[model samples]
Target: MTQGHHLRGIMLASVACMLWGISGVAASSLFAMNPDVSPLWLTQVRMIIAGIILLIMAQGVGAQPLQLWQNKYTATRIVSYALLGMVPVQLCYFEAVKYGNAPVATIIQFLGPFIISLYYLVFKRTKPTRSEAIGMVVAFVGTLLIVTHGHLNSLAISPAVLIWGLLSAVGVATNTLIPRPLLTKFGSLSVTGWGLLVAGVCLNVVKPLWQVHLTLDWAQISMLGIIIIFGTVIPFQMFAHSLGYILPTEASLLDAFEPLAATVFSVLFLSVQLTGFDLFGGALIIFAVMILSLDAQTLAVLLHRRHSRNTD
Candidate 1:
């Protein structure tokens, strides 16, 4: 890819993360306003609407839309991705924020990148470079600081909330890894479109969306529209498109913006607190992501240049 394209990919990924952060804040607000709305119901509306729109977009761009359900193996994989990755991601993260607050829930789900790194290290049998290792450590420490607020004895949230948050991280990793080959094959729009569609259908089976009634006012309807359009569809499409131009590692690193943005939005709109520890911890995580964005070769070259300058 050209330098400009690469830069554009990074920008796209960053904006996608920011939108996701905003979405979390919006979803949290919805939950607070409509305590009767079930997670499944909310997810169903968002997924089905966005999925339909994306499926149309996929076909408009000359992708094989039918292939998402034609070949049995491909269909199965798509279903698995929907059920295992997308469903868990949306449901768990939303439930996390519903149970706990948005900031803590978002910070906990930031473990997704580390989980991806460790998955490669253990399962793929790839040794992490020094930079990768150090970045992971720094990011992990930052998460701890954010979660525990420097006190080990007291966890800020309940165990169930923590479990849901970690589950969201798993969903994040699966969402990244499973769709990669699919993105290369069926295209991002097709895979995500089908995944959302299939997942929405499956979830509706469990909890019929018709049964969940919400007395939504105009403001609530507007918020739900933002959640569906700006939050679900656009950002997901942009993030998937960025993967075509950028590596998964870089894309994942860029996702550090999500939690930071979520924290800010939550504080501003949701009455969430941003304590000193949260700031310090969030900074460390962002710094760690920056480090991870630099490849081993680049870091090595920079070190070599620094050493030569020092010798002179």
Candidate 2:
């Protein structure tokens, strides 16, 4: 792609990450306002509503979403993607926020990018260069500072919240990686639409939405719309589509924006306090992202792609 297109893809991914950050704050607010709203139940609603809207949009763009069900193998993979990646990611994030707070949950989930890198190293035998290794260490230290706040003996939250937060990170990593081939094959919109639909249906079976009664005022209803549309649908579509243009590692690095957005929104809206250590930790994390962003190999790839496109 041209440099202009590359920049546009980065912008899209950045905006998507910011939206997800806002989503974390919004979901946390919903849980606080409506104590009766179960996380899984809310997730079910988000998946179904966003799924339908996204599927409709995909069709509007002339994408054949029905192709997802053309074969048993494809159908099964889509279902598994929903079950293993999308559903868990959303539910675990909401659960973490419901149990603890946004900043902690978001910071923990930020570990997903690094986890993706490590997974490649361990399983795929992709060795990290010196800069990437340093970046990983910086990210780990940043996470330690954010969670422990310079103390190791005590954590900032309960054990359950920590567990849920870690699960959210895993889900994020899985969500980013698993749908890649599907995105390449079916396009981003179709894969996301069908994945969300499958996840919604299965989650609804587990926790029927009809069983829960949510009394939403205008504000709550509006928040739900934002959650479903801007947060879930728009961001998912943007991130997925950007994956077609950018590397997965670049996508993960862009996700560094999410926690920063979450922290700002949480402090502003949820009245969460931001300490000096918090700022320091966040800077380290961003710096790690920059390390990868400025990597020689990554830059070479970008130049190569841009050159190839120009010649073509």
Candidate 3:
């Protein structure tokens, strides 16, 4: 990529991160209005609305052709991505936030990268490089610190919430890892939009329109719309566009900012109190992500040394 293109890509990616960071605040405001609304229902509505909007926009901009789904293989991949990745990730995450605080849930969900590394190690039999290993350890330790609130002895997290949070992480990892090859064939907007549409369809199966009541006041409806536009649609488009110039791993490292930004927003706007431990733990997690984003050559050297030691 040219320097100008690189700068534009970075700007786009940063915009995505900023919008995603503010999503929690938007969701929080909505929840405050209608505490009774189930997270499942909310996520379903948001995805459907965002998907429709994107579909329209895609057509308008000619970013996606009329026969976007003409290929059978592409259709299959889109369906799979939506059902397994988008749906589960969004549902599990909202559920996690319902059960636990948003900041905590956001931090937990950010564990997707580490989970992706672990998944590759276990299923693909791929050994993690030394830098990856260090990153994993640091991130895990940081998570523990955050979850336990720096008081390991007083760890009293709800089991159900923890399970949901971890499952959300898994869903995110699957979304990121499974679509790599397909992404080469299809543009990001096409993949994301179709996947979102599929996920919306799947969600509707559980809670039909007859069961859902759109009784929200103007404020709530406006918040939901903003969430759909800014939180879901805009960020995805910006992130996808940025991917043309930046590598995926680098983009993911930049995404680590979302959780940190969410934490800050939660504390500032929502008046969520963060103990000293929370600050410390959050710092560690950010540090770990930075280490992981280091150049691959450094990681390769470290991995080589570890392999040599193992042979010895």
- Highest TM-score: which candidate? 3
RMSD of each: 7.6, 4.9, 5.5
TM-score for predicted model 1 compared with the true structure: 0.86
Which of 2 and 3 is ahead in lDDT?
2
Instruction: Please give each candidate's TM-score.
Output: 0.86, 0.87, 0.88
lDDT of each: 0.81, 0.81, 0.74
Candidates 1 and 3: which is better by lDDT? 1
Worst 10 residues of 1 by lDDT: 298-307
**Residue 37 C-alpha lDDT in model 3:** 77
Q: What's the alpha carbon RMSD for model 1?
A: 7.6
In model 3, the clashing pairs are: none
lDDT of 1 at 282: 75
Position 258, candidate 1: lDDT: 91
Query: Which segments of model 3 are wrong by more than 4 Å?
Result: 63-68, 153-156, 295-312
